[model samples]
Target: MNFFIKLQDKISEFKLQINYMKKFPKIVFIGSTNFSLFSLKELYMKQYNIVGVITSPDNPIHKNEKYFSPVKKYALENNIPFLQPGNLLDDTFLKNLKAWNADIQIVVSFKILPKKVWDLPKMGSFNLHASLLPQYRGAAPINWVIINGENKTGLTTFFIEEKIDSGKILFQKEIEIGKEETAGELEYKLKKMSGSMIIKTLEKIMKKQIKPIDQKNINSLKYAPKISTKNCRIQWDDPSIESIYNKIRGLSPHPAAWTLLFFHKKKFVRFKIFVVKKILKKHSIPIGLIFNISSSEMRISVKEGFISIIEGQIEGKKRMNIKNLINGIKIRKNLFVR
Candidate 1:
């Protein structure tokens, strides 16, 4: 009897949500990654009137093979109409997008939109950025924040404009960054926290309760450009040990921080370091040289400290813990890293 009563209560709550969402304007969603999927799922669960979805074309995985994006897969499962346009400016694509007759659009983790598309909706479009606006205003904001050893970061919603991430702010929420948080872990936390914030933004916009703040008023802006291969390389001689620690965790699990392992100053192989501990101790060994190697651990000397490898991967081997990596490979003391 208790289970049945709880079930009925849940059903009633769901109905209430549906009734509340009836007043929401017709919404069109644009996104391509897992971060975008979280927002889309929240809106759908609240029974919002999602008119259509816009995502990138299927990505090629191998020759003659392609895979659907996370957003596209969700849209397919829920029977939501979606458009995969190769070019956002294509005539047919624009025509179909316009036909959706969206009252407003919400963009997250997607490409830059041309003005024509952003201006099509009667109510205007807004984008959700992963960082506090006027700072970290570019791709890979999450990664950059952790990489730079920032202790505080936040999310922002702003109107879409010609300049990327420079529009008027709709809403902002500050969040704390854990000292040991990796980029992937922080992203997960923020994505989960975004659902309620998105719902509130839509509610405020519909009620005309928002006073958008121009980003120009904010100062001390820092940019987060797209991370490149060059940026992921680890330099052992970097003066700051904290910087090295931050770099390893910032790029953890994806495009990780890497270095070259030179064995006896002859043959060299690449290594991707996934996890490490920074030990700040005075060391006489040369920087980037492997000072100690045990069956269960590996340590390399750096300026003013040592980097203890907890988890890592060789060029052609799968990721492994230090013990397993040691057992699999012959890591001699003379084998230095660069």
Candidate 2:
């Protein structure tokens, strides 16, 4: 009897939402590549009538003809219309979207939009950036925060305006970053947190219960640009203990902190280090000292202490026990990871 009652209640709620959808503003979501996929999935579960999905064109991958559009795939699977605008500012692009009479738009991990496209949404569009607005606002928030060794960072949802990531914050939530948190881990946490937060903000907007706060002190803003393979390498000559350790943790695991080692002064291989800890010792050892303690743990000397690299791999080689690596490679003494 209780199950039947609950089922009926859910069906009634579904009918109410579907009815409400006809009167509700049409929402067009932009940018559905990464975490945005989850945001769209959540919105669909809420019975939001997404009129269309606007995203970048599908590009070829793997081979010349193999192509994929992440947003288009998701939209097709959910039975929603999709638009892949090669140039967003094109006049025809404007004409097509305005025809939908969308209520508002949502952007997550998208390219910059021109004024013509942004103004199409009647209720005004909004975005959910990974970092706290007015700070760490750029292409790579997660990497920069971890590289700079920040103790805490947060997510911010804001009403999109003229400037990029410089809009009035609608709602913000902070997440305390663990000291050992890598860029990949931080990204995972922030994506999940921000996705739910975006849904909450949208619900509030629908109910007209939100209080917008102006972004102040724009001068304090810092940019976190995209990272390159060049900056991922470990530099032991760096004297600052914390900075070096921070870099090691920031890039470890995926895009691991690497360094170039001279094998027989002829070949160079990039190797990532892990299980790093600074130990104070009196042994007068120079930098890049490879100390073999066991088959599992090999302590490499840094400026302060031995940076224990328990696991790593050379190029085009299998990642195995450190002992196997040392034995296989015949890593000799006096060799430096320059």
Task: Give lDDT: candidate 1, residue 296.
Answer: 78
Report the CA-based lDDT of candidate 2 relative to the real structure. Answer: 0.78
* Candidate 1 ranges beyond 4 A from true positions: 1-20, 216-219, 263-265
Please, what are the lDDT tens digits per residue for candidate 2 over residues 224-257? 8777888888777786656777887777666677
Q: What would the per-residue lDDT of candidate 1 be over residues 157-250, giving only the tens digit for each residue?
A: 9989888888899999999999989898999989997878788888999999999999865467778888898999998899998899999999
For all the candidates, what are their Cα RMSDs to the real structure?
A: 4.1, 3.5
**In model 2, what lDDT does residue 279 have?**
60
Rate residue 66 of model 1 by lDDT.
96
Ten-residue stretch with the least lDDT total in model 1 = 328-337
lDDT (CA) for every model shown? Answer: 0.90, 0.78
Residue 16 accuracy (lDDT) in model 2 = 87
Show the lowest summed lDDT stretch of 10 residues, model 2: 274-283
